[model samples]
Structures are given as C-alpha cells and as structure tokens.
Target: MEKRNIAISLPCTGEEEWQATREPLMSGWLTQGPKVAAFEKAFAERHQVPHALAVTSCTTGLHLALAGLGIGPGDEVIVPAFTWVATANVVLYCGATPVFIDVDPQTFNLDLEQVKAKVSDKTRAVIAVHLFGRCLDIDTLRAALPPSVAIVEDAACAAGASWKGRPAGSLGDVAAFSFHPRKSVTTGEGGMVTTANAELAEQMNQLRNHGASLSEEQRHHGPRPYLLPEFNLLGFNYRMTDLQGAVGLVQLAKLDGFIDEREQWAQYYCEQLSGIEWLRLPTVPEGGRHGWQAFVLYVDPAKAPMPRNEMMEILQAKGIATRPGTHAVHMLAYYRDRFDLKPDDFPAARDCNDHSMAIPLHNRMDAQDYAYVVEAIRQLG
Candidate 1:
C-alpha cells in the first residue's frame, strides 16, 4: 500500500482564524457573548434573513427548529432516505416519526415525486437537505407540498449555495447550517439557524439557552445586572461558544473564496473525467449555485472495470483518499430495525449508498493533488 498525501476534506484555516480568536480569549467573556451576537448578525445579513441563531451543532440546530415548530409524538416529518443520519435522528429527538423519501439519482437531492407520494395528514414538516452543497428546488417542493406542511431546509452542506438568486438558508420556513470541519466554511464545530419568522427565532433562541426569558447578555447588561432570568419553557444548553463564534467570523468572511476554489476544482474534475462511461459526475440543477461541498460521483459497476468499493481501494492504494458520499439512513441499523425499513423500500437511496464515492476537492488541495486524483482514477483500467 502506498502512502497518500491527499486528504478527503480539510478546513481552510489561516492566520485570520488565529488572530480572530485572540480578542475573545483575552476578553475572558467566552460563553456566547458579543462575538456570538456579531456572528449571528452577520450570518443573518448574509443570508438576507431576519434572524439567525448560533448553535452548538447542526444536529442541535435541527432539534431546536423541530421543537420550536411544536413537533412531537403522533406527528410525521418527511426526510430523505439518503442523507447523514443526523437529519433523521433530529426528527426522532422531537419524538416525531421520520418518513423516509427517496432521492433523485442524478442530483442526489430529495425526489419530489417520492415526497408527493409520502405526505399524509400526519405530516407536519419536511426536511429538504441540500446534499453535497447543491440547493434543492424549493419551488417544486413548495408546489408539491400541502400548504400546512412546514419545510425545514437542512443546509448543513450549504453555506454559499443559492437557488434562483435566493440563498439556501432563506428558502425554507426554517434552515440549519453546519460549520463542521468538513463543511465549506468551518468553525471546527458549530451551526446556525436562519428564518424570516420572528416567532420561530425567539422560540429557538429560548430553546438553545435553557428557556430563559432573557439571554445572559440581556440580563447582565440591564439596569439590574444581578437579576436572574426566569425559566419559561423546557430547553437545552445548545449555545455556540465565543471561541467558535470568533472563528466563525473569520470563516464566514472567507466562505465565498472557499466555495469558488471548490467549484473550480469540481469543474476540473468533470473536465478530466469526461467521457468516462463507467463514472457519472455530480450535477447542479438549473438556477442552482452549488457550494461544492464534495465532488461525489457514481460508479456503474456494469460499465466500470471494477466495483465501487474496489475502485476506492485502488485509489487508496495509489496515494488518494476517498469515501462513500453518505449513508442511506433508512438502511442504517438504528433506523432499519426501528422502522422496519428494507433496502428496496427506497431503491434510489440504496443504489446511491452502494455506488457513490466522494473524491478529494477541498481548498487544501493544489494542482498537483488534483492531477494525482484524476490520474489515479484514469488508471482504473
């Protein structure tokens, strides 16, 4: 086995992040203070939404959104079968049933027809994930869905992604974005929720901070600094730290550049891999600006010289790192046994789970790294 210098994903960090952290650390007000407020404000302004709340993780952000929307037992939330398990797990956290829908084989997004077929009177919300940083067609989903069903955009992979000139975070009734290390723009580990609804924002805000009637800053900056806040509703401690917020500020500023770099590399991959009958590259739907979170491609084993896993192993042996795009959540052990799900229940997702592979396409890679990955794939003959 050869030692590979390439990485599957790497956060593009620099002196900006290090410099940004200094003030927050020196000030000694490290727990969701002014920096977190600034990050939320900036994120809200960038997404063109009325409110954005910083959270500890995208999972918690999703939980906050579902809980805020009053989802609980007896309710059904539709989610894609092919996505990170967290997308479905959050539905479970709210004690609501997650009705799994299949994904579009071409775009790897939630299939609209499956969505239409699965919706029921018990359906209270739908989680539309922007898989691989490509925005889902909100108009199509909105038209297919009943007026009562709420849409929660799972934009964990989408930071700079947009659809028809509208940003991803502003598309749904509520949205959750991740700033995990693997994301285009990262804060090591953080998340944000965006929404135009003030009421929902307030609900999520309270939910993230122990259901306090007032935030810590609100209580401390007021006429009575010693006064304690009253707990109104049940909540969780899902607040983003000042350290992460400070890092997020730097990452947010460089988000566009990061996306652009990934886009360029993705285009390069497409160009290099063109006419490879066995491989199917990713696609960006019309009016969609992909954030290019990962350049995932499908391997048709019938046409391909070897199986998808074999191809991955070959690439690994040749000094390249790769991964399965993501899991078919319904096929995972927890969801499978709990919901009695079968692979054939959502064929598209199962196919994706079996065939899709993600190649290296992060800001950390240079021309040499890109060439190496392309050459390694070409050698699959």
Candidate 2:
C-alpha cells in the first residue's frame, strides 16, 4: 500500500466480530442482557476485578464512577492537565470541580507533587489517567492521597495494561475503560466500569439503568413479570446493548494477542527511532506493561530540523498519518474561559501540547507498514 493509504489506526475486527453478533440479533435481545453479562464477567475476570459494568461509553462510565463514589457539589477531583478532555469533564458532570495539575512531560502522566499540592479536605477523588496506554503507578498515588480520596482509573487507553503486575482496571478504587474504535480492543463505541466493591458496583449498576432497583434480567426471570423496578437515585441510559456486548466478548478474547503484537512493534519503533536525538520516543515505566494503544513521539522544535507541526505536515504529504498525543484541556476554550487559564499555567502540559505526536500504531499494520513509517520518520531526521 502507498504511504498515503496508511491510517493512524484501523480496528482489527472482521468476520469474527460480525459472527458474534448473530446470536444477539437472532434472539432480539439487542439491549443489555445475557451477552452483556457474559462480556462483563469475562472482562472483570481478566482484569482481576469482582465487578465490571458495561456502559454506553467511557465518558458515561466515568460519570458513573464519580456518581457511584458520591462525588458532587462542593467536592474537587484531581486530574492531570495533559489527558483527554473526558477525564476532566466527568468530574464536572458530578458537579465537582476538576482541580487540574501539571504532568510529568516524559511520562505524560500525573505529576504526583502537583497531586499532593492540589489535594485538600474537599478533594473526593483523583482521575488517574494512564495516557497513551502506559499504566499509572496507582500504589504510589494511593499513598499520596488521603484515605477518603478515591482514585478513579481512567483506563480509556490502557486496556490490557498493568503496573507491578496488577492490571490497570484492578489498581484503582474503580476504573473506566473505552472501547472506541482506536483503542487496542473495541466494541465500535462503548465502555466498561470495573470495581471490586460490591456496594459501589451495585450503585453504578442501578445508575446505568435509570436507577432501577433491580435489573431487567431479575424482572424477566422473576415470577411476577408485570412488576417494574423501583428507582432510588436518578440515572442515565448507559446500558451497552447485547450486540455491542457480543462484539466486546470477541474483542476481549483477542485483547492479549493484540497487545502482544502492538508491544512488539512498539519495541521495534523505539529501537529503530532512538538514533534521532531531537525526537523523544515513548518509554514504558519500570513496572508498567504498556498496552501500546498509540506510540506517541515527542518532537523538540529547538533541536529538530523543523518545527513539530511542520514535521507533521511533511509526514502527511508522505501519506503517513500522525496526531498530537492528546490535547491540553486547560488550553481548550471552555476550560480556559471558565477557569481563566493561560497556556503557561501548566508548563509541561503546554510543552506536550505543542510537541507530542502519535504516529500510526495498531493491529492492522504489518511489518512492511511499520518499516515504512520508521523510514519516513528517519528520513525527516
């Protein structure tokens, strides 16, 4: 294939995902049902969590995590300034303030010092994001936060990732995962929330189903078929359909293999691209096994032959796609205007905002594609 035809990411789904949807379609149990339960069970077990609730999307899953944790008005949630907007947005959804903190530019994860400085009596939670598939050091963050402050793992880009042998979803009090098309595994557009606490899980379960006291399965299997569930707390329709659940199961089953393949290519890219001094390659943390969702590179405009954006343009002309690691939420219009923020307010986030670049990294890419991307980047040097 030509360089221009190479995509940043292409879902590795095919006939298997199509076939998995057959049962859900034939039974007409398209809504959340047996398939969703099965997918949740498999996901929870894989992540070593006792409960995993399928939701509409990671954005909604994050909302559920905060709501289940009882985070609301007058509370604050710590968030790394360098992550996807959803991380900070979810806190606001709970009527809680998202206390933004600078990030460690190298890791693109939370700066623990900032976390310590920003946390307070009103701090109810910290949305620890494992940006770019590198799992966060949850143990250290837990030690840093007060016992009352919960850690919500924003594992949106970290499926199959781990820290010190503990999976990403199992490390935090509760974790939210994305199944967007770009992730290592996908259900087209869906998400799952995993937690070990039964009480919290029950609350999230109810909230995802419009705060129903009992599940649809409970009603369907009960003797009184006409009885409707009671509502205790207000909730949203965040349930994942059986069709999506079916695809999720198949995707979940293949997650390990997918991660392994990506990891290999990531290593190869690191080895091959290390020679370019002006380009900073990604590095997995000491105890973290990165899921390799996207292999993001940091371009130093001062030393590089061209500016970061110029290099991106040149690559685009070569048909190789690239994107920033993620946006700096504080720089976005809504947050900047609402908070009266400046670009330099968070220096590291601003630096990353202008320099971090994510090249093509996905399961669909073969050895030739990887080599082509590497050569194209090396040529830039």
Taking the tens digit of each residue's C-alpha lDDT, what string does model 1 give over 135-227? 999999999999999999999999989999999999999999999999998888899999999999999999999999899988878998779
Q: Estimate TM-scores for all models.
A: 0.98, 0.99
Position 315, candidate 2: lDDT: 87
Badly placed stretches (over 4 Å) of model 2 are 1-4
Which residue pairs overlap in candidate 2's backbone? Answer: 4-319
Cand. 1 Cα-lDDT: 0.93
The per-prediction CA RMSD against the true structure, in angstroms, equals 1.3, 1.0
The C-alpha local distance difference test score for the whole of candidate 2 amounts to: 0.93
Return the number of clashes found in candidate 1: 0
The list of candidate 1 runs beyond 4 A from truth reads 1-4
Instruction: Point out the worst 10-residue segment of candidate 1 by lDDT.
Output: 1-10
